[model samples]
Target: MKQFIVELINDRFMIAAVLLFGLGFMNLLLQKNLIKKIIGFNVMDSSIFLFLASQGYINGRIAPIITNGVFDAEVYINPIPSGLVLTGIVVSVSVTAFFLALTVRLYGIYKTVDFDEIMLLINKEAE
Candidate 1:
């Protein structure tokens, strides 16, 4: 039990990622405001990035960059996860910006950012 607790403490990033993802998903699903939903999505994106970056981290290993005549895999951490997370961050930012733009346009049209209110207005317009 002590060892398990220690292991869990050592894997704090994974635990944090899971908690962040769950919180974000809950907020996204339960919130009625478009802006809040977008914020939740951004939170989830950050948690995913954290998880990915942590997966590539090694306690004592150097980066994958090779120098000093050292080429052993044990000495270098995997670079793919970090690279992918960097790309994901760029994409996440672009996507969040796009979503915010759409939210602004929706607010302009409906005069509100609440999802239910927007739906009601759209329905009333359709009728």
Candidate 2:
């Protein structure tokens, strides 16, 4: 148990990622408001990026940039994971913006962003 605790403490980024993902997932699943759901989605997205960035990080290494013709693998951390995380962040932002736009349109038409209320209105319209 002590070893586990020490390991967990050392891997702070993993713990943070898990917490963010869990919180976001709960919010997404349990909330009725569209805005809240969007926020949850953002939280989960950030957690994923955090996890990826953490995977790329090393204790005492710089970025994988060749400086002055000195090329040693040990001096530089792998850059791919960080690059992927950056791409994921950009995509997540765009997706969040799109979702918010849709939510705005829904609110304009229904005057509310509650998920159940929107479903009820749609069902009533259908019948």
Query: Which candidate's lDDT is highest?
Result: 1
Cα lDDT tens digits for candidate 2, 1-127:
9999999898999889999999999999999999999999999999999999899999899988887686888888979998899899899989999999999999999999999999999999999
Per-residue lDDT value at 26 in model 2: 93
For residues 48-121, could you state the per-residue lDDT of candidate 1 as single tens digits?
A: 99999899999999988887989889999989998999899999999999999999999999899999999999
Give the clash total for candidate 1. Answer: 0
Residue range with the least summed lDDT across 10 consecutive positions in model 2:
63-72
Model 2 error, position 58 (Å): 1.1
List of clashing residue pairs for candidate 2: none
RMSD of each: 1.4, 1.4
lDDT of 2 at 89: 86
Model 2, 91: alpha-carbon shift in Å?
A: 1.2
What would the TM-score be for candidate 1 when compared with the true structure? 0.91
> Given candidate 1, what's the lDDT at residue 71?
82
